[model samples]
Target: MSGAGNGFPVPDERQLDLERLDLERLARLRAQLVAHDCAAGLFYDPTNIRYATGTSNMQVYGLHNPCRYVFVPAEGPTVLFDFAGCAHLSAGRSAVGEVRPAVSWYHFIVGERVAEKAALWAEEIAELMARHGGGERRLAVDRLDPAGLRALEARGIAVADGQEVANQARKIKTPQEVLAVRAAVDGCETAIGRMAAALAPGITEQALWSHLHQANIELGGEWIETRLLTSGPRTNPWYQECSGRVIEAGDIVAFDTDLIGLHGYSADLSRTWVAGERPAGDAQRRLYAAAFEQVTRNIPLFRPGVSFGEIAARAQRPPERYRGLPGAALAHGIGLCNEYPLIVDPSAWEAGGVEGRVEAGMVFCVEAFAGEPGGREGVKLEQQILVTETGPELLSARLDETLL
Candidate 1:
């Protein structure tokens, strides 16, 4: 994963093969999908496709690329619908079972490649399913947009929303995946040292991020992620990108950033500080305090038999206010994705409906004051841990407080 584009250098770790993660993930996904009565599922989300077919294809470009869809028939095997000659995908350790590189899209339309390919690709998904074991097959679709939904509907395929099964299976971290996440966080923490080392008054946020970027590249940590080297009031915010703002003397700077490890696994971590005496800025102090308090509050809830809702209910703490910020829950999640199930914002973990618990061997980001969308500030907690028999195990050793 060359951090150069952000963190790891050339000869980077991004190239680290994900064969092991792929196998475990695929087996898990397959078992879950079949068990759910889904005859076949079309995965268009890049992450899902990668989980099934072992290809980043468009997921790597991050914001760009319209995404490549991979179809895995429950009765049959998995295949990818993309551009020319993707048969090589079958050659990898995490190989796809089949490849359908659509030719019509090549001469079909310009600027609308993904749309065109998707249109034609939807037909292929239907045809492939039919050929394998057609008619009322109880199909499922992952990440379907309006257009894609119409196309699948027209095909007469009974497509059900497949993300639910996917989310449940994906939330738990396999041991291999956990190890990879730990490695990624290690890279993030390493990059943090580099970012802090170059910090000082008069240094621009862009300049410090550049320093952090360079170190990540040199260390083979691909991508700087969110270079939030903010000062003072900005620290009380979200992933505010690097501005030309200068870190004046006595001001604070927080570099809430990360590096994706060699395995394409991401590490979302943050570090807050100042250019001068590292004054106990209310925002930083409150976040750290909330994080510590919440993590301590939630760690016990992570056992094998506890429900996520139970943990959420019990996670309340001392209602301290910082810069008028009220006290909040601590401990967020860290995994293949930034899925914080403990704080079920979008993913439904209501009382009695959700029985999800901390299974042993599951990896988590215990950055206190964290979890889900619609969360209060001071949630940029950044610790990573693994669930164990004794309890949640810290993977990234808690470092010395980097600031005074």
Candidate 2:
């Protein structure tokens, strides 16, 4: 399957080093802000903050506290409001033009100072906006504290949903972004390969799950998104997290690697396995076959000019026996996290999926699950794909031959 038989012109074969805040990416994001008619963009979401300024401080801590933020004006310099006295964290590392200390105790339970902190945070934001000519223009914020919102309203700065603007900006992958995601996938594949080798009977699900976490941390990745490793009957309904249950022989084990890897890019991949050295049972084999078919069959449906609805219509859905399983969408876009364009079956297209055409440089994860109602175990498979001008290009590594 080469040449124009797939679709449009094939993209160039170029490689790039993963620089999280390359100049081009920053410029493109700022351009998107301007295009959205935003005077300035303020981000409290950790991912959005990093995307805007290429700086992250106490990210997990900041998720609950709105003290860390990034501000990007439509035509001026970028700024990072650091948490507490951590302004030095982003001084020379990020592309941001300015770094300021803006501390807030929004998550603290020490009396009512949280609201006072929020007001202070809002006042600092107002001052920043005024310095950047955003006083009379609208400010878009991805997440805001209630008190901060009130203060913004008092200051007469119209606040819009910055998450929408950020999502649209991030929907398309720049060359460097694609490269970073590929690097993240490479790291995840390495970790998964190690896990594959370590899989065996009598190993606790927690032990196996720890291998992935350890490997990811050693490889400089951020925390994983979920604890989705389980064995045997626990694998049936799909939302089970890893536990202390010892994996028995002939049991089915499944895991989803919703990992945030190198450079803050996400690599979402899933694999299922049999615990014993012996081959998978007939029913397990059938389930695996169905899941594999679902992933491989629907990949080509994603390409430039293909509408999400059409892809949903043509996608291979879960088998009838597994119709009641927990899966909701057949495929979805992936970037810093599971981003956009959840492609569903035609029956669910209007309800769950968005209406838009796939374009070049969009990355997606085609997901599939198969398990009977009240069954013992389930099979899950996922593939990371890049929608190129020509067709869908697989970014994830192939499953181990033994698993097939």
Candidate 3:
């Protein structure tokens, strides 16, 4: 959209080869299918479908309505079952080979005939496996209705965890994927600048949050995953969606830009700032400093070859007063969406932690939240990082100096 004033150069779309990206992503998914020993992958989740085929149509709508899906064979052509009459959408895409009308079996669509539709859907899938599965009946499916699963099982098809295959495939970013991520972050930060410039006393939280949405849409970005902008006391307990509460002078406005930017990549970054020109008070500064330190301290621990547990063990904790509240993750992988390898605090690691190693091509968002127990204010800070062979590279480099 506008010039890159956020230090990172604006991504040149000319440099992005969509066909190459599609091929690379398809190869990655196939590799994962081979590793998982599945003959094919049946992707119903729109994100996984986009990853495997690079063809998108009504992504959010496709999420809940299983009206669209793709059949990706481990060693054959990709067949897209598009929404009725929407097969034209995948035309000219090298990643997609055949396009057919989808058989939707969701309750909203088929009502009492769900079983009938699911049977039809399963038959086609079984036929595809017979034709291209090389005698393997195992299929990896990301998401499916219970009826659909039962119907497939009736046909002797074995289903495996397809989400795992998709996640593992999406974990390592190709060089082109990294470039796409850079473009997304650049667009997201530009939108963040717009939102920040609009912050002032008397502005409703919803109104302020809309600036980020408007700027993202104007820049060809898709959608924001959450409305996380909050001000004043609302910022204390995190995860409060933006509302009509009018911001006051010196109020702390904290938000996470779970922005899905250009090319369907995500730029999940967060920041907190004081509302008005009135300088931040002592409590505000202390919260901001702690949150800032937590993010900055944890970022360096994310070099290649490090274990997820090691990162959590060595992560910097907030002051004792602020330790009562913790965000969902200390660091998590970022790709098409917040995908895998959710690193958490040591206290909660036993339950929510994942087993994984930091690879050079992976990207992550290091997170921090500092809000004293019963305090009126809090600070949320996050940074997007790309793991290099040597160490972490800060992708979201424009931190608020005034608040810091």
Candidate 4:
């Protein structure tokens, strides 16, 4: 636990406030939409809807069903299109100007189902736009079924991809958002500490993994976003999900706690530890040392106004022996989920890389990995950060370097 300390001077749990949404964030979204020239925004992605409207109901269900959505006019108030009969919930919890019943998939019977629903939805959307002085103006959408898109077009509303605008709005953290993310990371660190105290040989990866999940649930976390917990050979190539394979002595156990925790923000941190009480063998120490170096070396480079591509160019590679292991980007933005401005290897910069200059209030995860290509084990490490007016602040706590 050396290089990166907690991103903020976190208060104890009893004194900490974890509420995530506020009028300020919603205001920021409206401003971004206007700047993008989006007369109004129609958001169907569950996360986008949550960001724009500050309401949640059966979110995972809504993700695939499209039963719930949000409509935000750039210059006026926000509106939520929740499932029928659920307006009260939105009214109770959201800052929206109005709550309207949307066509839930449950109501589709058979004949002309999509057409009927789309027409109904379009009518409401058009009325809302017209009320906001945006008659026949552009409607940016994050996700919409083809039937709905065509219906909006038929209704004379221009539809375009609004995901980037949503990302831009959410990229910078409000003060409350920062506090909420801090609380999430605190919950995550507590869960990880529990796992470390309970670490031992013969524990199944499933059982070890459940400790974090249980702790997160108890701490008011919404969900565990990934299943990446593994040990031994499964740890080398990366992305191997947790299995029933029993951890053995001297094995290296690694996991990315991609947990969606308090206030619906994410705490995405990774750690690798040696199984059992004994000290690591030579190979374990070698890989772990390399990973530690790669992670710690880059934390200072994420200052305000720094270029993401420049950081990518200077990113430390896996120690020479582990050069070619398959892995994702070295790092990416984290909020409700891995959001934007992915920092990748410089070699891939020209091939669809997202370029941007880091700014104060931007949160990023710095990642590093080490393994012999096609070898038995590897190490993965990541640290959450907040780029500030001064410099980068480490949001995540220090890892147990002794285990590595």
Candidate 5:
């Protein structure tokens, strides 16, 4: 367990703050991009940029200064959209010289000094990239935004999507990546405990969620959206909750959330419980039992080399059908975003889903849902998992078989 005996290094408390990111791994990534025809990767995705450069502090103020960008030109140095009050990024810098610092190639069309500066800055950045041996080759953008993308095309510049290049790189997580996921799971368990203690029959669903939000922030949750606490009949496929709805004695309180740790690792999980003391009501009991069955009995099919299509085939609705959400797949992969390439649904594979084999260090969440369609109750449960040579390791260990 110490050093790399387990083939993974566990960092101490101070080290867990994201001090040791793998720069060599990043070098290989850059080499891969260079090998490909990609030049000037315009990074718009926050997590994508963070994974490559090891800094999301610039995006902490996403709403106002939402126009942060990072560019690693094929033959040129790396560049970013420089901002005020961003000294924290340099102080907490991860891979020091790996990311060559340059400023603002793309500009935001909105906000103060945004539109005016964006055009000028974009021109300046383009010139810098060209001067640094960047040929007139096509540049890649992540999303298919026709405006910015087309505008560049109008200027006779070839544009590529950054996502196309990134997807293949992030699929297979390294050993260090697995450790970060485990740390995120630990933080999520603590947050869940605080939320559960705050739940009560008379308390509103919103109030329960408020407790979770406050606890997560207090405990250093980097960015958690939708601390979804769906209850009673509101628990179909909707992934949000309102505190206005009071928890009835027999209601099924489903706790679901998507979270990011301080280290930029993500873990999305859901746990449903029937609120009662010694005697859990009939509908509530059924929901809990079904949810338990999914997480305990059915969820373990997510092993290395196992195809998602194969897992979906196991969930056929019949005599041996798995019970959870009516049309929900078993789960999905949790990374920079709550949702990404890998999904637990069997049909997802039918759609040409992820084909990369799950390696020893891949981190994912095994989401399990149980509820009768058109029925008045529902249940959903999820846990963070890190795949290893031995098997799947549970990251969130606070999860209990039954409600507290």
Candidate 6:
């Protein structure tokens, strides 16, 4: 856990201050709720729940099931509605005041009784709101089904967009949160190094990608959010997941590690490498140089006070042949997941762009991809960056020197 075989240091979990991290996150959420003039906030997204409570249970499972949630009053202690018999998961967390069995009304769980179950769920939540809302009925909900929404509305409760509140609250990271991000990136870079070392001819792309998964888990990281490892012909088009095709010598292998690492923080970094220690082809070199240049140039534009549109306007773009290729952005915000503040390609700015200023404590993923219109291979390069008061700090600095 301390260091990988490739000599990259893996952070020790004991060094993180979990309590301060948890409390600060909760405080941020509460402040956002108060600013939005909401009496309480209801969270169904596992990422939002984790941000507000610092506890998790069946994170992936909870995402699709919608059987777990948490309630946070603007000024009171938070309560977690956990999965059946799973209340014990938050036993030692000070941010969570109470744990109760959740009411699950999803069709898969309730069948013909969805409405009944939803009504029951609404009654409990309404009772809590009455007691803790200080006579206010405004409830911000991250996500809910139509039935659940109707059930709450029938009781005269006003529903607001809780996802926006959560995102704005999470936009700025505390100092403790930054430390957590650094640790996740350390573990992720170590895993990436391991994956690169295992690259060889005759290995299937899937087989090679598994090294990253294994190393991440062995280092106490959670799940990977994507399977974007491809080689040679599969590398073009860029969104192809890892397959069983055997990689031959000199094939360009490209991958994006959309890894959710330690403490549920993401370490999203991408790289391309040539197999078997062979020199890259002329086309490969050109593609890689373009991607490398784009990432390096865009990263420095993430200084504090810079607007997202400004960054997009000033970003380095790929060549004309590589323009409009799918599956990557100029830059994006990264946290427990790919959160907010996406800086898109300038060409698409008029339609898909958003307005926001880059601020200190915000982390971003700067990305670039270079693949010719009819080429058989491509290069994808990305770097994780932390925006500080002075400038941008590169979090994942492990680049493939040979490929570059």
Residues 1-404 of candidate 6: C-alpha lDDT, one tens digit per residue: 47555576787677678889999999999999999999999999999999999998999998899989999999887989999999889988988999999999999999999999999999999999999999999999999999999999999899999999999999899888898898888888888888877888999999999999998898788999999999999999889889999999999999999998889999999989899978898889999989988898888898999988889888899988888577588988989989897888898899999999999999999999999877899999999999999999988875666656
Please give, for residues 98-207, the per-residue lDDT of candidate 1 as tens digits.
67763333222444665665577678777887876455566777666566667667877777778776776677777667666766766666667666667888888888
C-alpha lDDT score of every prediction, in listed order: 0.60, 0.80, 0.90, 0.81, 0.61, 0.90
Candidate 1: deviation at residue 353, Å?
11
lDDT per residue as tens, model 5, 142-254? 64344455445544567766775766556556656666666666666666766777777888888887766675565566776665778888876545456588887767788
Candidate order (TM-score):
6, 3, 4, 2, 5, 1
Write model 3 residue lDDT over 190-258, tens digit each, in one string: 788788788999999999999988878877889899989999999988998999999999999999999
TM-score of 4: 0.93
Task: Please name the candidate that would achieve the greatest lDDT relative to the true structure.
Answer: 6
Give per-model TM-scores.
Answer: 0.79, 0.92, 0.97, 0.93, 0.81, 0.98
Tens-digit lDDT string for candidate 4 (79-183): 888877888776555457888777653344334576776787788888888898456479889987777788889978888778988999999988878877788
- Candidate 3 stretches with Cα past 4 Å from truth are 1-11
lDDT of 2 by residue, 21-86 (tens): 456567767787788787888888988877777676777777776767788888788888777678
lDDT score of residue 23 within candidate 3: 89
Q: Which is the winner by lDDT between candidate 4 and candidate 5? A: 4
List candidate 6 segments past 4 Å from native: 4-8
Candidate with the larger lDDT of 1 and 5: 5
lDDT of 6: 0.90
Better of 1 and 6 by lDDT: 6
Looking at model 1, residue 130 earns an lDDT score of 84
